[model samples]
Structure formats: C-alpha cells, structure tokens
Target: MHLAMIGVGYVGLVSGACFAEAGQTVICMDVDPQKIEGLRRGEIPIYEPGLEDFVRRNVAAGRLSFTTDLNDAVDRSQVIFICVGTPSREDGSADLHYVDEVARGIGRTMDAYKVIVNKSTVPVGTARRVRRLVSKELARRGLDLEFDVVSNPEFLREGSALHDFMQPDRTVVGVESAKARQLMAELYRYWTEKKFPLYFMDVASAEMTKYAANAFLATKITFMNEIANLCALSGANIDQVRVGIGSDSRIGDRFLFPGLGYGGSCFPKDVKALIYMGKTMGYNFNILEATNLVNQAQRHRFIFTIGSFFDHQLDGKTLALWGLAFKPNTDDIREAPALTVMERLLDLGADLRVYDPVAMLEVQKHYENYPYPERIVYAPTPEAALEGADALVINTEWDVFRQFDVSRLKNLLKAPVVFDGRNIYDPAQMKQAGIHYFYIGKPIY
Candidate 1:
C-alpha cells in the first residue's frame, strides 16, 4: 500500500514511519521546507522514545520518504492521513485553521480515488467539512474524482508512541461508505489480524469519541487530585485510598495517581474545547468546569506545599527541581506542571536548579528570558541539581529520580527536605532515611 501523510508533526511522523516499517511505502508531506529537508536526511524533529530508531530503520530500508510537494503525494498514494495540530484558541475553542488549511490543500491536489483519513483529534463533524471541501475542489477542476473521508483518531501516548501504535487497544473507523471501510480495513490489516477490533461508526460518533475519552481521563485525574487535597487536611493518605478504591474492577487504577496534575497536549485542550462547544449550544458543562478548577488548584496547592515547607520565606531559597517535563521519557513541555512550579517559585523569590532526562533544552528555549540563569541552573545530572540546594522538589517521575540514592541526596542538599509531588516513594522510606518528606494526600514527615 502506498500511503501519504500530510503534516510531519509528532503524530504524522510516528504514524508514517511506523506504517512504512510495516511494509507500506509512505511519503510524508510537510509545508516547512527545512523540516522536510531534515526528514529527507533522516533527522527527526521531536524527542520521543524509540522514534529515531524507527525512522532511521524505515528510511534506510527505502520504504519511507519525505517531500514538500502536496500534488505529488496526492498522485502517488491511495490513502492520505491528515495529522496536523489543532491548538486551542483563547476562548477555549480548538483553532482548526491548520486542519482547515490542509483540508483545502488536499481538495486542490487530490487526483483520483483516495481515502482521506482524519488522524488528528478534531471537533465533531470535521469529516463532513473535509468531504465538502474535497468535493467542491474536484468540481472546480471539472474532474468528478471520488474521495472518501474517514475518521481514524490516534490513541498514542507521548512516551510510548511506538508501542501504542504497534499494539493499539482498538482501532476506530468512521465512514459513511462501505468503500471507505474496506480501504481502512485493508490498511489496518496488521492490527485486524491480531483481533484489534475495528469499530465502524458514523463520522460524528467517532469524532466525539476521541474528545470524550480524553476529557473523561482528565476528569478522573482532577477528581483524584481534589480528593488528595481533602485527604491531606483530614489526616488520610491518598495512596492508601487510591489502592482501596482501585481494587474495584470498575475503578481500576490507571490514571488515578495523584500528582501536580494532568498536563500534556491532549487532556487540557480537549476538555476546554468540549466545554466551549457546549457553550456554543447554550449548555454549561458543570463537571468539566469543576475539573478545570480542581486541576488549576492542584498546581497552586503543590506550590503552596513548597512555600509552606519554607514557611513562606521561599525568598532566596535555592530549590533543586528533579524533573522539568510534564511526565517522564518525553521532552514535551506543553501544559507541564513543572513550568507552573517554576513560575510560582520564581515570583516568590526562590532560585531554581532543574534537571530532566530529556526536557532541559526544551525548557531553556522558553526560559531564555530568565534574567538570572546564574540563579536558575540546569544540572547535567540529578545529583548536580542538588548541589548546594536548599531542598529537592520532584516533578516528573524519571526512573533514575524514582530510584535515587537516599544517602547521596541527603549529603548533597543543604537540607534533607523533599517535596514529592508525584508520590513516587513510600513515606516510610523517606522517614527511615531521616529526610523530611511532603507528598500528595499525606502529611509531612
């Protein structure tokens, strides 16, 4: 199968490369000339685990390629995946300018029968709009070329994108025509063979399903964070409560880990977009509203923990930060809680020493405006971050940070105080090491 992927962003790149690795010839198209040139040379722009190896291997095998010509991609491939970004506007609506532009571009360039798949998460009814655009453009060219629009949203998590792509829990296909379904089934033959059910539904439900899944997960995290806060005040432990409640098969634990909060490209934007869409229909989403409130409060609460630890005299406190990215094993900083912690601590007059496995350079790009790089240090290692620090605050749960030597941490820091935002270690262990530890849903010890 010859496949064309428009927009070589995170999803497009990973999906296109992985498809090529699965024996399909893939041509990735992008508007940016520099990005296309880099891809031609096998230079990946994003930092994802195992992605570079996947891209390099497929490119070496001649199954994958890159280009900037949209018409050529349209002419060569029978299936096209639209995997562009849909960032949120200030009013919390998903800004579909990029997706719209690509749809229009596809309408103009498409030559023959092709399955135009929506691989990016978009608001409902986008597939109809895409179908209209392509139809209008084909009419304009006076070529009655047939094309079918399908919704095939991705469920790839950032850290484990390759794994998720290879072993998806399920594959969704939204199509109005049996022809589109057959083409999609043929494309996903690899997954279908392994019994990953391909759900065929109308376009609207498929679009709504992606937003619903992400928003629900975000709500779960927000609810747990709120419960964790109440637990801290009521002399209860969230970890224990989480385990006890999660024992139920219905409430099985997955995203229930209480922490600074849920932050990434998907959850925050999708929640707001859903609420915004509801408002456009004159409905207020009360549950989503509360979820947003609780998530915001969780960040401030974590900051308060750090402030209370220092008795609000965080002024001139040299704090060591263990993680920079929102989560571990990826360099993505979009909506990261660590950035919120950094800003609040800086405003309160604390200096920061930060370290992460992969997000240091990404953080530096945004924090280049810091007037005190002298005060805000970027450590090469976790121990280097603790050099002469007042205390240690854990943000992302990198494997090394989770298993750091307690004695070394005590010897390196000026104080043995730790604000464990992720609750990675047991309170008993921190207590046994003679370290002052403050964690979510648990009292300071």
Candidate 2:
C-alpha cells in the first residue's frame, strides 16, 4: 500500500510511522519546510513514547520517507490521508482554515482516482464540504477525476499513541463507495492480524464517534472530580470510593483517576467543539455542558485549596511544582491543569520551581511571556524542584513521582507540607515521613 500522509504533526507522524512499521510504503508530506527537513534528517519533532525508535527503524528499512512537496505525494500515492490539525476557534467550533487549505491543494494537485481519507478529528459533514470543494477545484481546472472522501477518525491517547495506533480499539472507516472501502481495507489489513476489528459506517457517524469518545472520557473525569470535591467536604476518601464504585462492573476505573483534570490535544477541545456543533443545530448538550463547567472549576478549586492551606499568604513563598504536561509520557501541555495552578499561584505572589521529565522546553516557551521570569525556575530533576520550597505539589501522575522516597523528601523541603493534586501518594506513607499530606477527596491531615 502506497499512502501519502499530509501534515507531519502529531497525528500525521504517528500514523505514518505506524503504517510504515506495518510494512506499507508511506510518504509523509508537510507544508513546513523546516519540519520536513527535520524529518528527512531522522529527527522527530514530538516527544511520544516509542515514536523515535519506530521512525528510526522504519526509515532505516527504507519503508518510510518524508517530503514537503504535497503535489508529488498526491501524484504518487493511491491514498492520501489528511492528518492536519483542527484547532478550536474562539467561538468554540473547530477552526478548519488549515484543513480547507489542504483540501484545496489536494484538489488542485490530485491526478487520478484517489481516496482522500479524513484522518484528522473534524466536525460532522466535513467530508461533504471537502467533497464539494474538491469537485469545485477540479471543475475550475477543467478536469473530471473520481475521488472518494473517507472519514477515518483517530482514537489515539497521547503517551500511549504507538500502542493505540498499533492495537486500535477498532478502526472506523466512513466511506460511500465499495471501491474506497476495499482500498482502505487493503491498506490496513496488517493491523487486523492481531484481530482488531474494522467498523464501516456513514460519514457523519464516523465524525461523531471521535467527539463522542473524547467527550465521554471528559465527562468521566469531571464526574470523578465532582465526587472527589464532595468527598473532601464530607471527610471521605475518594480512593476507596473509586474502588467501591469501579467494582460494580458498570463503572470502570480507567479514567477515574481523581487527577487535576483532563487535558492535552483531545478532551478539552473536542468536548467544547461537540457542544458548539450541537448548539449550531439548535440542540443543547446538557451533559457535556456540565462536564466542561465542572472540569474548569476543578482546576481553580485545586488552586484555591493550595492558597487556603497557606492562610492565603502565598506571597514570597517558593512552591515546588511537579508535572507540567497534562498527563505523562508526552511533552504536550495544552490546557494542562498544572499550568492553571502555576498561573494562579504566581498571581497570588508565590514563586515556583517546576520540573517535568519531558515538558521543560514547552513550559518555558509559555512562561517566557510572563513579566517576572525570575520568579519561575525550571529544575533539572524532581528533587531539584523540591529544594528551597515551602510545599511540594504533584499535578501530573507520572509513575516516577508515585515511587519517590518519602523520607528523603521530608529532609529536602523547607516545610513538610505536601499538596498532591493527582492523589498519587498514600496519605499514610506521607504522614509516616513526618509530612503533612493533602490529597483530593481525603481528610486533610
């Protein structure tokens, strides 16, 4: 299978690498000349677990190649996958300006019958819009060529993108033609050797599935956060409650982590986009509406807890903050709860020393815009982040943080007070270290 993947961003690169690893010949194209050159030099732009090795091995095997010439990629491949970004607009709808540009370029450059796969997470009816635009472009060029647009929504969780792509829950292909379905199946047959099923559906349903998956996960996280908040006032332990509820078989313990909140490229934007899409058709999505509200409130409430813990006198206090990315194993910090906490703490006049395993440069890029750069320090290690700090706050639940030596931590900080936003540590163990531990949904000790 010869496939041309447009846009070498997160989705495009991951899909291209995985497809090449599956023994398909893949040509990944990007408009950014610098990014394409980086790829040509075997340099991956994003920090995804297992991706650097995956790209290296495939490129070594001569199965994967990179280019900036979109026309060449389009002309050479039978299938062109549009894997561009659809960032959220100010109005909460998906901003499709990039997608529209790519669609027009593909229309102008497409030579023969090609299957254009919408691999990006897009709104409903975008396939039809692409189809109409492509037809108009072809008509403008006075050429009549057949092309099939397929909506192939991605359900990849960051930090576990390689696994998600290799062993997908299921492959949803929204196609209108039998020929297109057959071509897509041939391209993806290697994945089915492990028995991952392929689901063929209508275009609209396929687009809806991506939003529905992310929105449901966001709702789950927000629901747990709400329960955690209620437990805090009632003097209850959310860990025990989470276990009790999870054992019911109806409720799962996957996204039920009483963390700061959900973030990254998917949940926050997709949920809002779904709400905006529904509102356009005069449909009110009460569930997702409440979900978004609760999620945002959780971040602020966590910040308030830290302030109230210190009697609201956060001035001149140096706080040790761990975890910059929304979750872990990825450097993406979009809408991360840790950043929200950092901002609020700074506003209240507290200096911050932060560390993440991989998100250092990302956090620095954002924090550089702040007026007081001296107030924030990027530590080289987790222990360095704790030095000279009044209290330690854990935001992202990375596995390494959970396994830190508690007794040594007691000896390192200015004070023995620890605020755990992810509830990663055992309160009993923290107490044994002569540290006052505060976690979500537990009695503040």
Error of 2 at 319 (Å): 0.3
The residue-by-residue lDDT of candidate 2 on 1-445, one tens digit each, is: 8899999988999999999999998999998999989988988898999999999999999989999898999988999999999988898899888889888999998979999999999999999989988998999999999999999999887899999999999999999999999998888789777799999999999999999988998999999988998888887888889998988777876888786888887888899899999999999999999998988988888888899988999998999999999898989999898989999999999999999999999999998789999999999999999999999999998888988988898889999989899988888888889998888787543
Best by lDDT: 2
Q: Which ten-residue region of model 1 has the weakest summed lDDT?
A: 436-445
Name model 2 segments beyond 4 Å from true. Answer: none
Please, what is the TM-score per model? Answer: 0.97, 0.98
For model 2 the TM-score comes to 0.98
Q: Model 2, poorest ten-residue lDDT window?
A: 436-445
Tens digit of per-residue lDDT, candidate 1, span 1-445: 9999999988999999889978899999999999999988878888888999999999999889999998888889999999999888999998888888888888888777899999998988789888888888878888788788999998888989989998888888889899988888898898889887888899889998999899999999888888888888888888889999889899988888999998888889999999998898899999998898889889898899789878988887899998888888889999999999998898899988999999999999989988877768999999899988999999999999888878667889999999988999888988888898888888533
lDDT of 2: 0.91
lDDT for model 1, on a 0 to 1 scale? 0.89
Cα-based lDDT for every prediction: 0.89, 0.91
